[model samples]
Target: MSVLFFDIGATLADVSVAADGSLTFHPRPRVVEVLDSFAQVRKGIISNPGPGATARENAAAALEAAFGGRFSDEALVHWGAKDRRGIFDGAVTSAGPGAGDCVFVGEDPDERVFAREAGMRTAAHPVFTLAAVEGRPVFWARIEAPDDRSPAELEAVAKLDEVVPVHVASDRLVLAMATARGVRAVEQSGFTADLRGQVGETSAFLVRDDRPVAVPVAFAQASAAFRATAEATMRAAAAFAFVSAELSGSRPPVSSLGPGPGGVYIAAAAGVPVEDVHIPGARPGHIERLLPDPALLSRPGQARAERFVTAFAPGAPSQETVDAVRAAVTPPALRAHVARISGAGPLVDGDPLTVRSRDASSADNERVVDALAGRLHELGLEVRRHEFTWRGHRLSNVEAELAAEASDAVVLVTAHLDSTGAEGEFFDSAGRSRPYDPAVDPAPGADDDGSGTAAVMATAECLSSMVASGRTPARSVRFVLFNAEEQGLVGSKAYARAAAAAGDAIAGVLQMDMIAGFQGGTRTMEIHAGSVVPGPVAGASDALADLVAQAGPAVAPDFTVQQLTGAADPAVGRSDHASFHERGWAAVAVSENFFDDTGPATGTRQYHRPGDTLLDRDHDTDYAASIARTVAVAALTLAGL
Candidate 1:
């Protein structure tokens, strides 16, 4: 596989950036030598804003000076900073000769983590040369040692101005900087660019809060293009301050939390200085989430400053102040909070909708959910109504079907209504958060839960069809749509409780999440039947594995299963299946294994984020579909469908 490397800084330029903005430069000689060494390598340079040459107005002259005709202008790939962490995390995921064959190199530990998390070998730059001299004229320093460089670093240094990988981390800052430069950051949601921009040799000058620190206007205007880029960059920086301030979640009125003044008043009234409270990472628009209940402030006969005492830290309460405050402020009566968001009742409107990013909104999966619900409704099956809860939301749980033609055994199949990943809001269109919203940034979702939703819907649809065809099996089938799965297995827990409460005979639970990826055969599938349950359930798990080995090839026609043991623990219980096993329900989850199991090889990278879209370049939904088929086959066989 041909290795891939990336260039940081100017290539993915930071127009108006913070003082800590890191720049990764390549040693020209080492890069050229590596380029020559790999004769059959497919090489290309990916840049943003424009190539160094087009960054300024005197493009032709700058190109001649930098390349001497050795490189063509078309050699550069300009990818503006947008998302962070993934292929653009500056690590090589797929190699040139073939997929999963190459390596990635660059500087920056943050970038390295992003790449490593993406399942790529990463290297950091050990040395850098001074390309442009200014400020005391020639400032020289070697930050990291060359010989001690990591594999990714060496590879990245070798690809500088060559075939360096682009970044994968979110680029809110970089785009802010570009906007400061008067350059527009394209909001494609998730799509590849078709054209590139040109740039010329531009002198580097630092800008702090809109003011040029040391460079002279004479130097900036040495050329018209140079001046325009700088002017535009400065303007963008000024504009970005306002936009960033809005996003930083500072204080209210002007921010999300609450007005800055209101926060200060509340803190002061409590005798706690606003700074002492230390609400880290607060923005303006979301201050209400940080403050105490307003009812506490409106109590009758309470002195203005008396209410603050009760809000102090644990054990620091002043008895005199506390008693006086309690006397002054009467607490509200009869406010009850439930342990689980879901109640043992039917779903209600405005209970909050949960849909998986790739699954819930998927036209294919939506069809499946609808079809199955319709099928179940059509049959004379005695479906029960109950509430299924997860995260902080609730959903309707319906159960029906026979365990056996004459027996009372049961099988459970569940789909989550919540979506995963960063970019799922497009489905709501009415403007709801996908998995993570600006309300809750850093959404670790997408295929992780979204794909699972699809699998459950599909499986339910299949079973519903079978039932509608008058096929009465020996086992009872239960179809559940869970909520708040991303937070933990809360929904499943509620379901288990409800089942135990009603004394329902649940034989086993089969969970299918993120099934739209390859398992075995070429990549091979991994079965996770750890000792989450004991005795018959564990035995059933072993039997289920054998069944997959027997039936998967026929069902999927290719994939195979590699049963795994000894890795199940609290950490393993990331999905709803855990809740079932804990409740003594014979259950096992079938997934894409991700990096840890019999699942996708690249789960860590695109597992979430805007890049986790249907059109992600790396994810293969077709493979995912096949994997989903295997899961369905396994569930049907285990339930003796």
Candidate 2:
């Protein structure tokens, strides 16, 4: 008898787990129809449940509630991490002798690779189970009309069989994954842009698509094309997108996967412009994403301040005051802290680096937290660890709180500490990187977050010195380094959840992400103040952003801080600050220039990759200091220092 295994979460449904071990999952598009169609074939599960001892029970309860009597065999339902081949191997073994007779239907290509290794055929979407059973290779393709053609001409793409248009990039561009026959059909329609073979090579892409916009045709069209790709990727179909630095109107596109302010996010050739496939009128831009995040769909955009018709001037703090904050967070000090934590040197005494990936799965995660705690202890600060579980691993959100003489409100300076080298990246088998196995991948995320981590550390170090000198702020300040941030802000989310449960009054949060990357331009910095258009606490978020921008003139005179809020704030809910924002707490994200495409583009192409190490020249300590100082000054000012 033929048996089948299905992956849960994004593959089957969008999931939610209540505090009481109850699971609520909404089936994705055709999940029910597809599962019912395969009634003759025996179905089993190979899925990763939430952390804690009752995770399996929660998943089973949700499964049974959603599709009662569908998955009856308790023996076939295997719940475990699918990051490796062992789980698939066990599933195959349990299914009896003929492994080739079984098929696994899941979303992630990496998971598919493991199943393939277990001698089972794989399908990305449940809709493609027939193809998986029939042994047909499925391809994810981006089809777009020429710059000269209208987007409406490709409407028939939605009508095609075998080709699934997962994301509607634009009227002209559509991102879809299909079988060989579907690819042929799309090519016959006169729109042919085929990515490299298979999905496992690249996790996802940053697609940038807009109208057939005006010049600089060089970069605008590229950016537009990628925007569409980013949308497709946001829907979980990966395609090609360019890093911000490469699409500098003057420079050739450099292909490297990095999360954009928009968040599924993109990779390979150096200096080769991202393959811009179009049949008609093509506009140039870059494709960007965070892995198909529904939460980010309503998040704000990342345009420059100039995009808005109205504006507010920053608070005028004394230059001397700015200088005091700047003096506290120096380039050398920031670099030293970054070097210590980011695998350049030993993290404190006992922690040496074999690899520096703080991915939730890595044991090194705890060591990094302990190292940060050690530094805080040296400054005589109160350190605490809020431990949480994720993917069956124990992780902690490290914190160092400074008490106020008398105040009920608290200000938080935060950054995510976890890193990943494998997500949204591609390395040819012939090239150096031996297919990135998360179990052994190297994610020395020096810039992806080591920069932000260093900034947060420096902020604490400086503030601690001030407090030692008797300049205590009225409001308490908490310096937080979040763990497993790369795993969808797991630590921050937990913190937010607990704080909400306790009714903690958090005034505001200043989140600094990739501050060390300084490519060029007016040294412009972006203040992501969340969105104001329809958000509940837009007014509070706006004020918080203004505080950050006001710091630019005082501390970072050499750098220009373009404050963006309202509809266009790119980081909307993609960063850690979003956690607090969801709780109605005022918050903002500070980072390098990922917006302002017309200006000298700035930011790291090595985002989220193993290349985010201390050895890379992409990190600019001076720029990092400026950003750190900006955030530090704002936090201090808010705390009534």
Candidate 2: 10-residue stretch with minimal lDDT:
300-309
TM-scores for all candidates: the values are 0.39, 0.55
Clashes of each: 93, 49
Predicted candidate 2 versus true structure: per-residue lDDT over 1-641, tens digit per residue: 56889987666765543323366656655568788988877789988774566888878988998788888878789988776889998888888765347888876656777888888887777767787788777655666666655433444443334665433333355555667777776667677655435443234444434323233334455676575554544432222232344345665333433222233234322222232232121121223222322122122221212121134233566554566677779988888777776778777756455446676677777778777877886777777666554444646787788888778578899998887775335565576644455666678888878889989888888888887776788889998888766655667866665555344667778898888887665687888885422334566778778888876767788887777776455565557876666555678888887643445557877776778777677788988888888888888887777
User: Candidate 1 lDDT, tens digit per residue, 418-457?
Assistant: 4444323434466664333423332323355545554554
Residue 235 in candidate 2, Cα distance off native in Å: 6.9
- The segments of candidate 1 whose C-alpha lies over 4 angstroms from its true place after superposition are 1-385, 388-394, 397-405, 422-446, 468-470, 518-521, 532-536, 567-571, 595-604
lDDT of 1: 0.36
In order, candidate lDDTs are 0.36, 0.65
TM-score of 2: 0.55
